[model samples]
Target chain A: MLPVIEAGTGPFTQPPTINPAVTADWLVAFLQDEMRARRSVAKAVIGLSGGVDSAVTAFLCARALGPENVHAIRMPYKHSSPASLADAQLVTDALGIHQHTVEITGAVDGYLQLEPEADARRRGNVMARVRMVVLFDQSAKYAALPVGTGNKTERLLGYFTWHADDTPPINPIGDLYKSQVWELARYLGVPRELIEKAPSADLEADQTDESDLGITYARADAILSHMLEGYSNEQLAERGFTEHDVRLVRRRLDGTHWKRHLPTTAMLTNTAINEFYLRPVDF
Target chain B: MEPPVNLDHRAAPLRVAIVQSKPRKGRYEENLRELGEVFAQLTAAQPAPDLVILPEAALTGYFLEGAVYELALDARRFAADLARTWHEAAGGATVDIACGFFENAGGTYYNSAVYVEVEHGKHCVRHVHRKMFLPTYGVFDEERFLSRGRRLQTFETRFGTMALLICEDVWHAIMPTIAAVKGARVLIVPSAAPGRGIEEDDELGSIARWREILHATAAEHGVYLLYAGLAGFEGGKGMTGSSRVVGPRGRTIVQAPALGAHIVRATLDMREIDLARATLPLLGDLGAVLPDLLLDEELPLPRGLHASGH
Candidate 1:
C-alpha cells in the first residue's frame, strides 16, 4: 500500500498540553461575548449527556452566563442508560444550575413508528434530532441559547449525525479534541468517575464509542492532534506512530472534509453569496 | 572615559530565550517553581542561552484587582532568593534573567522589572526599572494599586547595554526612544496584553499591533529588540503570547504562535547593530536635536483672553 502520511515536516514531535484554568477563562469570555453579540441572550441551555464534552461546555457556560441564567437539559430515551442520567444529574447539582428532564423516547418513537424496519443508524439519528428539538423548545421558553457539546474528534471522524447534534448556534468545546476535553474536564473539577467512565454515544444497547469506531481515544487523538497541527501521515509515522493507525486516522479525516465545510454552491455569478457583502457578527 | 572599541570585531552570537509564561492569579510559589523548571531546561542544553526574558507581572500576575498589595514582593529580599536559585540551576554557567514582578519597598508597592546576572554562585542586581506609565483605562488599573518609577536608566551588561520596558511602557514610542538614546543597544519588553478582537484568519489584532511597533522602533534605532509576552487565561481575559526576536534591520529572527506557552531561542550577532546604525543614522539625528528638546525656564505667555465654552 502507498504510504499514508505525506513525506514532509510535521507540526511538533511532542503532544500539545492545555492549561485548563486558562482554557476555562477563555471559554467563559468567549461564551459571554458570543451570546451577547450573536443572540442577544444572557442565558444558555446545554444538554448534559454524562459525557466530558457536555459537562465542560455546561460548566463554562454556567460560569460565563451565571448559574441563574444557565439551564441543563437531560434528554434520555427509554433505552438510554440510567447511569447516564445519574451522571448528568451529578453535573447539574455540582454546578448549582437549573436542570430539566425531558425524555426523548416519545418524540423519537413517533418518527420510528413510521419506519419500524429502521436500523441502529436511523434510530440513533432520530434520537439525536429529537433531543435537539426538545432542547430548543427549552431554549425559547427560558430565553436561552442552546450550546453545542460536539467536540472536534467526533466532528473530524463524522461520528455525529449530519445536522442533529451539530445544530447549536454556539459552542465552546467544538474546537477542543477528545483528549483535550478530558484534560479540560479534570481541570474544571469534574467528578473523577465521569472522566474515568468509558465514552459512549448512548445510541444502542451495549455500545462503547471506541469499540464502535474501531479506534481508541489515545491513538485517535494522538494521530488527529498532530495531523491538525500540520503533520502528515508520513510525519506521524516518523514520530513513532504505527503505520496502520496513521492510515486509518488519515482516511477518516480525509473522508470527513466535506462534512467540515459549508455546503459548496455551484458558482453561477461573479459574486457568490458566501464571498460578497459579508459582515462580522460583532460588527 | 574609556576608548571606544570596534563593535564589528570579536564576533560571537548572543542567545536569548523569551518565555511566554502561563501564570495563574495569586500563585506566587507555583509561578516561582515553574520558573525554576524553565531555568533547569535552558541550562541543561548545550551552549546555554546568554539571557532569558520573562513576561510582566509574572510573580503576582495581572488583573489582581485588589489583592496585588498583599502579594507584592520585597524587591531586595526577592532578588537575593532569585539569585541563589539561579546560581543553583545554572551555576558555573553565566545566564542573566530579566523578569517582571510587583515590588514592595518601604511599605509602597510598584510594578517593576529586575535584571539579575548569575554565574558560579555569584549574582548581582544589575538593573531595576519601575514602570513609568501606569495605565488606568480599559482592562488596566495599575496606577490605582502601585507607584510608578520616576526614572528611565539604561545599564551596561557583558553582552551589550540593554533596557527593560514593562507591558504598557512599550506602547508609547517615547519609552523605546528614551532607552535607545540612553545607550541601550538591545531593548527588551515584557508584556501581559489580553488578546481582544474579532477572530479573523485566526490572527490577533493586538498581537499584530505589537509586532508592528517593535519592528518600527528596532529599524529606526538600528537596535536588537526582544519581546516576551505572557500567555494564559485569568479573570475573563485571554493573555496572548506571541513572543518574538527582531534583528537590527527589523527582520524577525524567530517567533512563536499566539495563545501558547513557548520557550523561544534565537542567535543574534551584536555587530548587526553597528551595521544597521551605520546604514540608517536616526540616532545621530536625534542626538543633534536633543538640545532643542529641553527648556531652561518656563516661557511667558502673551496676554490673551481665555475662551469659555459655549
Candidate 2:
C-alpha cells in the first residue's frame, strides 16, 4: 500500500518523516506545499477563547503562515470574564498578529428573544457556534482557513463544540494532548501567564473542563494513553485505574463516536461513502 | 390498463434461494446431508428455484485460522458431485448450483465458491472465485490460510450476468463496484457472519447496514444483490444466518429467520435495474461529481473535512 501523502519533486526532495514529534520547519514546509497547490494566500483565523489550547494553536499557525497572514478574533459574550479578553489580547500582541474583537452578547440576546425557550446548554452551544460564524466570515474575507485549536485531550473526551470551536480547515494541535500542548506552547514562546492559567470553557462562570468530565487532565491523559496503546482491562485495573473510571471513559468514547463521523446518509450504491476500510493509505 | 402483451425482451424472473444452513460440528458429511435435505425440500416446491446459494466456508464451519489446512478439501469433487445429483433430482428443471468449497490445488488451500452447471449430459464447474478480501481484524483470521484472489470475474448465468463474492470480498467496495460496473445483474455474496449477541438488537443494525451498502452498490451499478450467510454455531462462534436478498430499491425482499437453518427465495426482476439507473442517473452523474480525494481507485481517510460537494 502507498502512503497517503505523495512525496514532492523539489529542492527538498526527500519525504518528511512522520512521527509523534512535530517540528516548526516541517509545519512550514507542509503549509507551503498545501498553499501552493491550492494557489491561495495562506492565512489563519483563530477563535481566541484565552485558553491555552487556542493560544498554542494560534502561535503555531502564525509561525507557519507568517504573523502577517495570521489573524485572531476574540468573541466575547456578556458573561465572559474580563481576564479572558485581557489574556486573549495579550497573546495576540505578543504574537504580533492582527486582532479583531467581536461582542456577541447582542447576537445571543437577539437570538434568545426570537427563541427565548433556549436552555442554558443550548445557549452556550449557540454562543460557540456564533463565534465560529464570525471567524468563518473572516476566513472568507481573507481567503483563509479557520485553524482549529482543539487538543487531543478535548477531542478524545468530545469536549469541543462540533462545527464551532472544533471545525477548521486544518487541525495541527488536534493530535497533541493538553499536557503536550503546554510543552509545545512554551517551546513556541507563548506568554507564560496565558500558559499557566487554569483552562476554562467560559460558557458559565468557573466552569472547568474537569468539572464536567469528573476527572483531571492528568488522570484522563494517563487512562487515554493506556487505551490508545491497547492495554487490556485487567492491565489497566492492575495499573491503578478503577473499573468505574475505565468504564466511564469507554462509555464516553462510545457515546461521542458520532463526533468523529460525518452525518450518516443512506447509501444507495456499491461504493458507500462511509466504507473507509478499503482506503488507499498504507497502514 | 391497456391490453397486456408478453414482450420478447421481458425475461422471466429467476427464482434464487439462499440456503442459510448450520453445518454440523466439522462433520463435512453431515453438513452435506443437511444441505441435500434442504435442497430436496426447496426444489420439491410447486415453483422450484432456478438457483441455490450456500454460505462461504459452508462445507466446513467457521474454523479457526489453523483449521483451514486441517479441514479444507479439493472442493471440485464435492461441488461436481452435488451439481450432478441436484440436476438429476430436478428432473431436467435446469437448476444452477452454487456453494462454498475448500479449493486445494498444488498443496495450497483457498476458501472458494464454485458454480456448477450440468447441461445436456455434460457437468462442469462454471466459475470458481477465490475469496479475495480477507478479514484480519477482530474474530476473523481469513488472511492466515487463504490466498487472496487477484481479479474479480463475472459469469453469464441463465439468470443474467452473475457476479460471485465470498464474505470479505464484498467488504472491498471497489471490487464489488467494478463487478457491478462490468454488468453483473445479480451479485451473490456467501458469508459466515457470526451471530449477534443476545443483548444485540433483533434486526442487527450492522447486518442491516451491510445489506444497505450492498443494495446501494447494486442500485448504483444497476444490479440485484443476493447474500447467503451461515446460521447456528460454527466452531465456538455462533453463526447469525440472517441471510437476505435486497433489491435495487434498497429494501430486503427476502430474509431468513434469525437463528435457524433455512432457505429463503425471492424472484429477481433484473429488468427493473436498467430502469432504476436510467431514472436516477446516479451512475452517469457519479464520475462528474465524485470528490478529488475519492477520484482515484482508493478511498480517502474521511478526516471530518468538508466533502466540498463536487
Candidate 3:
C-alpha cells in the first residue's frame, strides 16, 4: 500500500494527503525546467522568510540548481522577529547556499514617514513589498531569477499582499496547499523548528496565520479541497464541517478570485494580451 | 496509392521506438531542430528503429492556446520538413515516423497527427488523423481554438493495417472499437496528458487512469498498443511521460520513466495479435455485431424518453 500523510482532524473521512517523495521530484523538475530551459537562467534567488513555505522552496531550488546556484535573501523590517532570521539562517547553513541579509527597515520607514498615520495593515503591505524590492534587486545583482514562496492556501484565500509575495516570475510551491507544504517541508528535511512553529506572515508582532484567518490550515485545506471538488456548503456541512467554517472559507475563496489573476485590462482591441490574445507563459 | 514497400514478405518483427519528447511551447523551429538531433542519434544506433512514434504536439508544445495558429504547418509541408531533416542527418536512411502537431489545413486549424514514410531522402504522407474530441473543461480550451476531425481511418503499412489516435480520441471507447473493426492490428496513441491529481498511488492520478484505459483498450481490441507521452512542463503543467508499449494480451512490454525525456523500444511480432485473438476473441465478437450496433444508434429515443433526462 502507498504511504499517506494524514492531515489532522477535519470533516474529511480520508484526510487530504500527497506523496511528498513524488511531489518533491516533480517540483524539482519543474524548477529545473522552468529556470534552465524556459527562462534560460541557471541560478535562482528566493526570499527566505524562515517559514515552511519558503524553506521548502529553498530546498527544491537548491536541489534543482545546485546549492551554489541558489541564493537566499532575508529582508527583515525592524520589528520583524529575530527568531525568523535565525530560522532562515538554519536553512542556508544546512543547505550550504549563498545567504544575504538585507535590512528593509530603512527602506520601509523612508516611505512610511511620508504617510505617518498609516495603519498596521498598510505598514505590513509596505514591508512585504519592500522585501520584494530587495529580493528582485538582489536577483539582478546575482543574475538569477526571483522565485515565489507563496503557497496555494494563501493564494486561494488571497492572504498575500498583491505584487509583493506573489510577484516572482516562478514558484515551485504555489500549487501545493499550506498543509501539503508542511508535509513536504518534513520530507525535504527543513529545520524541524521552522516546520513546527505557527505560520505567520510576520508583518506585525505575534501575527499567526491561523489567528488572522480564524481557521487552522488543516481545516481550511480540507474545506478548500472539498469545495474545489464542487461540493456545496450544504454538502460540506453534511460531511461534518461547521457552517461557520464553511462560509468563511467560501467567502474568502470567492471574494479573492481577482487576486489570483492578472490585472483587468480594457479589451478595446481584439489583440489585447492575456484575454482575446492568449499564449502560454513558456511561449 | 501503391504500397511504400513490398507487403507480401513482411514477416519480420516490427521494431518501434517511442520518443517521449519535451517540445518547447510555441517554439516550433527549435523543437524541430531538437527532433532532428534525436533523429540523427537514432540513425547512428546499431539496431536503428524502423518506426518512431512521438507524443501529441511533438513539433509545438501542448497548451499553445491562441498561438496554435502561429505554429501550425500544413501536412505536406510538415512531412517534407521531417524528410529534409532526416535526409540531412542520415543521408537517405529509410524510417517511418508518426508525430503530432497542430495542423493548418487551408485557413482552418486542427490538433493533428501525421504518419510519414521517409525513404531514401524522399517522404510520402501516408495519413493524417485530426483529433476528434477537444476537451474544453478545466485546464483545457481546445474547442475554442481548433476544429474537430470527423473521420476514423485505418491505413495499410508494410507491417500491416495500423490506426493512429490523438490524445482525446482514445479516451472514447468507440474510437478504438471502430479502428479495430476496420482491420487495424496496431494502435498508435500520441498523447499530451497533463499530470494531475495526487492520490493513494506513487504515480500521478492521470497516469494511473491512462494505464487502465490503455490496457483495457489494447486487450479488448487484441491489437498492439503504442502510447507516446509528452514530457516537460508547459506553463507549469507537467506532461506525464510514461510512454509504453503494450502487447495484444494487455501486458506492458516496455515503459519509460514518468518524468523526463526518454525513448523506449520494443519488438512486436504480428503473430501475437493472432494468438491474443485466438485466446480471448473479444474483437471478433464485437466486429460481428458492429453493423447492427451502428444501425441501432441511428434509431430515435424510446417513447416518453428524451436524449436528456427530464
lDDT top scorer: 3
- The alpha-carbon lDDT assigned to residue A106 of candidate 3 equals 97
Query: What TM-score describes the B chain of model 1?
Result: 0.90
Cα error of candidate 2 at position B180, Å: 1.1
The DockQ-based CAPRI class assigned to model 3 is incorrect
Off by over 4 Å in 3: A1-283, B5-10, B297-310
The C-alpha RMSD in Å for every predicted model, in order, reads 16.9, 19.5, 23.7
Positional deviation of residue B3's Cα in model 1 after best superposition, in angstroms:
16
Off by over 4 Å in 1: A1-283, B1-10, B199-202, B296-310
**Tens-digit per-residue lDDT, A1-283, candidate 1:** 1011111223333344588888899999899889976668999899899887889888898789888888999999999999999999889888999999998888899889999999999899989888889989999999989999998889988888877788898889888878888999999888777899999999887899899888888778778876774555765786688888889888889998887767888877767676675666566
What is the RMSD, in Å, between candidate 2 and the native fold over all Cα?
19.5
Candidate 3 lDDT over residue span B14-58, tens digit each? 878888898777878888888888887777775778888999998
Task: Assess each prediction's global lDDT (C-alpha) against the native.
Answer: 0.81, 0.73, 0.88
Q: What is the TM-score of candidate 3?
A: 0.51
Clashes of each: 2, 4, 0
TM-score of chain B of each: 0.90, 0.84, 0.94
